[model samples]
Target: MKLILKNIGLLKQAEITLYPLCVIAGENDNGKSTVGKIVFCIIKAINRYKEDLQESKEYQVNEILQEIYFKFRRALPTDDGQIPDVLRQLRAITTGPANLPEQLATVREALEQLEQSGTETRSTRQDIMDALEQIQLITDQPEDTRQSIENAFNKVFASEFDASLLLQGAKTGTIRLYDGDFLLIHLEVNAASGATLKGDVDPINIKDVTFIDSPLILNHHDLLIRSQSMLDVDRKPGRSLGRSYTTLHTKDLFDKLKEPALPNDLFATRNKALLGNIQKLIAGEISYDKSSRDFVFTKNAKSISIKNTASGIKVFGLLQILLANEVISKNTMLILDEPENHLHPKWQLHLARILVELIKEGIYVLVSSHSPYMIEALKRYADRADLKDTSRFYLAENRTIEDRNRLGEIFDVLTEPFETFRQMDAEDLRDE
Candidate 1:
């Protein structure tokens, strides 16, 4: 897969081709996360198009049902504590969203039955039946890709689309994704008209993609409790769309973590081994302690709150939980940003190995980092596994290049501090 981004966030233009596993190396504020976010918005919009439509339809239908029920009470109420038999029959509306029309048909029948029972006047009965006809049960058709992408962008970014997102002095911008020569997605944005997209979007091979920018998400994991999916919280009726400092990506990760751990027969042997290694690295298990309502790390029969563990533990613990929950699968793409942030050099290498191993199993991973140790480890491990052919590396500058031969340039950018320290020598240390 290849991506082309222009005038989005801090990036003026970047064309990066992704492999089964692509590690992007760049300095801070150079748009590493920006590229990742654009891709996330595109892929998620395509993969989740149908599911989101369902959620919206469900929400709408529930609203209409509520209105009809309210009118029913006002129109006809038995003298005693009874919920008239016809009303009671309509009470059990246990139909799925996909069969929404059928559910409405059932409600219509209840209204017709009420009319026959003579519980209310013809005038009152006609008013209730009129509501059923007026109900707008059909979901908006996404005949084009622009609608889907904009919805995803709105929810994921938690803000309205505007010119402020464009690069300075730029009138227009675009983000495009392609499969070699085939254009899968094209998004054009400008200060004047906002954003528009065009693509053949359905449930593609990637049904979902999770972007883990930091492990600190475990700190405020409970903000959105029992969220079934992104739409569950995002589509809420009257909530402010402008989320000042957070994105839905973090909440999505928490939902993935909370999902019931996939049962056996799911990559039973391969993933089981990976999970074991992760736990061993942390020297414990991290799980939600229901009794305490907190995340706790357990080691040697002793447990402590996750807040008390090393930041590195939080990193590996997340991997362990995602693996145990069976959320890491070939179909799910992962965009990991600066995973080496809090890891020791040794563990960074181990993390590299684990990432390479994931690609070997057909899972796609995109990692952005500034750690030479992490980059070198990934390169070497890719070689050792004989999977180097499946991996690609990119340098995230304003302009783009494959950047393999110019590895030194990237390393220089990342390792300049090391060079500075070595040049300082004993005299500089004594002076300090």
Candidate 2:
């Protein structure tokens, strides 16, 4: 699956081959999430695709097309040579705009009027001309304008996911790969005017290509979304906090792990697998308390959940939930941003191992990390596989004005994987 992006968000251009269990590692504020958004857009395009994108919203198309039109109009509008620009402009103006359903309805009505009038009228151009004249925009006349808008509506803005929709502190998201393979989990939220806007998404497109299923849009983005402030909530189980901010007790996990569990329990079947993995990861015997709901570990005696628990643990739990619930499946691409949060060096290494397993199982994962520990973990994993120049690793840094084309760093952690890991980790420590 090859995916192409033009002037979409922060990415000017990117061409990446999709691999199962691919990881995207970059610094903050380098358009990590934007890549996800483009993927989501592509999935939506596939969903609403038709012989003519007449069913597509106008304003959405306009956002992209309008930019080009204004640019070309400034450069050379009269140039019939600018038909591509005109087509691009048409593509932009045809997609429905945000908070402008009335405009879409108006455009739909005008098209209907033109179609109805064409039966009685000798020329279809006359009806089109009449419609555009009423559209409050200057154009080359009815037929040209109507056809232009219609043409714009038909072109698809192919994409798979938006990272910002899934990860926090991610803005100016970008598209990474050109792979058209994606899954669209659309979440819509009610608007102030009793309308709805896309809210959340789940995409499985990464650097190494893997196609899972036919693209489908799940209209539940509304329920899964939340603001960054919600992350500040205490993880303790309580009615006063957001669902994503909370943690599960060991006893609760154990009970849920039991077979024939409630359908509503998110981690029921996966909990047992998750527990075994955790124990194996630390090379320890683990026990849980039914009273305090804490986990006790032997060999690493200090690993009592009370003082040893961290955000990394919670993040692992969340990932486990996602896997257990089949949110991410076999032969799917997973784009993960900042997976090293609150994890110790040991756990980071363990995560690297887990990621390697996922890759071997044919699941693609893309991850961006600020932790040198994570970078080192990846180094070790690459070493174990005897991978020369780990081409999967990427880093983002301040690009010189002269090197604008090089917005991020794509490095093959050859013999210097460990050294590269140390340098990056040191840089992060200095920033902190």
Candidate 3:
């Protein structure tokens, strides 16, 4: 998949053609993280929509209309206490053109009855009249009304609604994903207001994408310790408290784990090998104890809780469990933000190798990193004959796709700290 972005955070414009292994490298605050988050948000939104559709098992149109109606009914004035009847009439009237005339007749009869009773105030009569006129307008332009309703519902359910809150200072942006000559999906957002302006394409059965931000660590803990009762807590009051990208990613991971695991045969050979390599680096096997509701690490005839493990181990441990449970597969788009966060230099190299192996297994990895060692290891491993064409690298500072030669330039810049140290040593010797 190829992702194109415009006016997103510090990236004025960036078009990245994602291969199985893709890297976005730059100094801090140069939009590398922003790109990762945007991709994550888009993929997360599409996945959420798919999950909702699958669970409801209803026609998309009907599902959207029902939600809109719920909101529309709630917003109606309660002066008449007849909104429920009004909604019923509206639904009945919009069923077909044949019903329009009959519905209009009913409305006329009701107006007559109201006039005859003379018990209601003029305000009540005016409200009914206005509602009737609106209904007539909607009935007269049925196609337009349906299109308008779909657009309204799409806006309400768009991923940007929550992404805007998670990605602070986001203003306006456009995301376009394409496969070869075909444009798969195009989504536009006004991030400040959490509104999606153009998203007409139905994203059902599209690519499976997962985003990993900093909160993966916290989410890992939640997965180990969270219970059904904890998730059942009333989150209405906390809705306004705002969630970090990590929090949302963690919640999604938690939900995915609730599903039954796929068969072992469904696991690809390369994925298993890659995961095995990571396990070797961690020096232990990470497994969730279903009966105990805890993540246990067993190594050298000793068992320890995952919470007592090191941060780097915890990070890799999360990946281990996700893959073992088959929540991640070859079809998954794995976006990682700073995967090197808590790792030593050697472990960073290990992670780079694991990532390359994931790409070898047909998983698409889009990673944002500031670590030189990780990027260098990735370039080295990706250059292998079988993996050469499966990888692409970019320097986010220039906001352009880069080849190995350009990556060398980035390497030079990243290594300037060594030159500074050398210069300081020379000055100290001269003063001596």
Q: Best candidate, lDDT-wise?
A: 1
Instruction: Give, for candidate 3, the lowest lDDT window spanning 10 residues.
Output: 228-237
Q: Write the per-residue lDDT of candidate 3 for residues 1-432, one digit (tens) a residue.
A: 677777665666778776778788877767787666666655655555433333222222233333434433443445466644555654554343334456566556545544555554566666666665655544454243324333433432342333342234556667677777577667565644543535454453336666666523433555334432111222122333333332444455555543343232223443677577766878776666555555667678576876777778867876776777666777677888888887888888877877777776667788888789889888887886378777777787754333343576667767889999999999999999
Per-model lDDT: 0.70, 0.40, 0.60
TM-score of each: 0.85, 0.40, 0.65
Candidate 2 stretches with Cα past 4 Å from truth are 1-4, 40-275, 279-309, 382-391, 397-432
* lDDT winner between candidates 1 and 2: 1
Model 3 Cα RMSD, 1 decimal: 9.6
Over 346-389, each residue of candidate 1 has an lDDT whose tens digit, in order, gives: 99998998888777777788888889999999889989989778
Candidate 2 lDDT (Cα, whole model)? 0.40
Q: Ranking under TM-score, best-scoring first?
A: 1, 3, 2
When 1 and 3 are scored with TM-score, the better candidate is 1
- What TM-score quantifies how close candidate 2 is to the native fold? 0.40
RMSD of 2: 18.6
Candidate 3 segments exceeding 4 Å error = 53-171, 191-193, 197-199, 202-206, 214-246, 256-272, 398-405
lDDT of 2 by residue, 30-93 (tens): 5544444344334433333332333222333344334433333333333355443333433445
